[model samples]
Target: MSASRPVRRVDRQALQGLAHPLRVQLYDALVSEGAATASELGRRLGESSGSTSYHLRQLERHGFVETDPARGTGRERWWRATEEDLRTRGADFEDDPSAAEAYRILDTEWARSRRGRHESWRASRREWPMPWREAAGESTSHLRLDVEETAELMAEVVALMSSWAERTDGRDGDPRYRSVEVQANVFPNGRPPGVSTD
Candidate 1:
């Protein structure tokens, strides 16, 4: 699906605003499952309507989510993710300890949520159609590269995903189309081959 807006680079202020675990979960739900009202989200997330509503408002204030204009009435208030891809770097907050802590919190929660989604998919893969079962899965590649090369590789991967998103922009209502998650992890192996910690 197409983003309603362009890609958003998350600043320190936004990062701090979105650092809460519940808020992150709420935003993730809207992104992965489309729009829903506070009560509906509460039911799915096992949270109180009041809690979800409060957290959703926080997410909205930081521009991570927005009211779904097409879905609910004025009182119902359906919420959906803004569709903008968010990019953040730990380096951005290196000078500010509190901001760094906020980044860490958001990063940890985001990674945990992603892992949970993959685990859920794995658990239910057998229930899916044969084509999807065969097509969807994970992969890893080991490469020995310096920092610059690694960055270049990630940039290419982002470009590829963005192109695919553009290619499938208007296919939201198609029955065969599914919400799929594609994750990429690039990092140095712990300690490296000849590192000395002592």
Candidate 2:
């Protein structure tokens, strides 16, 4: 993905465009499930095709998605999420009230979506194959690291994931294999042990 396109630094306008709940979900579905027509997405998301199509256009206006020519026909159009790594700098919106609010809403929705997806997976894990079930689990650890170290560690972990991701790109010829979802959360606790705020 890095070789293909540069990272997309989402600006205030784009961030505000994606602040809509349905639009965010549509973008998420496109990225995770690959390209699809608006109708197909509507079916999967239990929304009207008209509604999905409208929101898809809105997403496109902000460069969040684009037309997928290979998947389209005369009467239908397919869309795919951009390969760019979308990022927003919180500091940019620190002084702007409106932009900050938009950022807060989008950020909150993102976190909520992650939690919801994980909970859904937990609920449905039993239906999956035994091998997958055995391989899937979560753990919590208390790490000793400052802010900068934590960021560096996360960057390393992302690089590792990017490498692993290349192996699963394109069609799945092997029924024995499945796309796995990996999630990680790292943050600082309020002052480490024996540290005084004063």
Candidate 3:
């Protein structure tokens, strides 16, 4: 949340490197788990250790992750996310079809990750206290705005989210504290019924 690390803006090369579903899965695991050995991540993702290690090195080459020296041993290496957050702008690859395809693949993986998390939360909600169960749910809103306005709104929301992230970092010692996932997205809707732009 309040990570001292800067958000890494992924370039096309990195996007291509992460396009594989398994690599995307491994990257997410490394970020969420803080640090992990290839074997540990492999177990979580149902992949072989050799495969995970190969993909982890692929991530390292693209600067998405790195060796966690403090957590590594003589026989095993630990890896961690290089950045607290990562982002890519599809428009950046507008002229390159291959890069654009890579972006799409990564996007699909991101959506899958979100769906998995949502399902997991729903499945486990019963184990949580009533207060938490009541507080956890989805909210949706639709607004009409020009491109500039939409950009401004997204920036504001990100700032607000960052503030909360900063505040929650040191509360791990609290018995009642639990990690919560926050997802925010705003994009232009595809052609609605009775609308045409072609």
Among these predictions, the greatest TM-score belongs to 1
lDDT for each residue of candidate 3 in 78-140, tens digit (9 for 90 to 100): 998774557688899879999998888888988898889889888998998899999988988
Which tens-of-lDDT digit does each residue in 71-119 have in candidate 1?
7776889888887788999999989999999999999999999999999
Candidates in order have lDDT scores of 0.87, 0.82, 0.82
Q: Which residue ranges in model 1 land beyond 4 Å of their true spot? A: 1-5, 192-198
Residue 29 CA displacement from its true place in model 2, Å? 1.0
How much lDDT does candidate 1 score? 0.87
Cα TM-score per model:
0.92, 0.85, 0.85
36-93 in candidate 2: lDDT tens per residue? Answer: 8999999988999999999999999989999987677889999998767687867889
Residue pairs whose backbone atoms clash in candidate 3: none
Off by over 4 Å in 3: 1-4, 169-177, 190-198
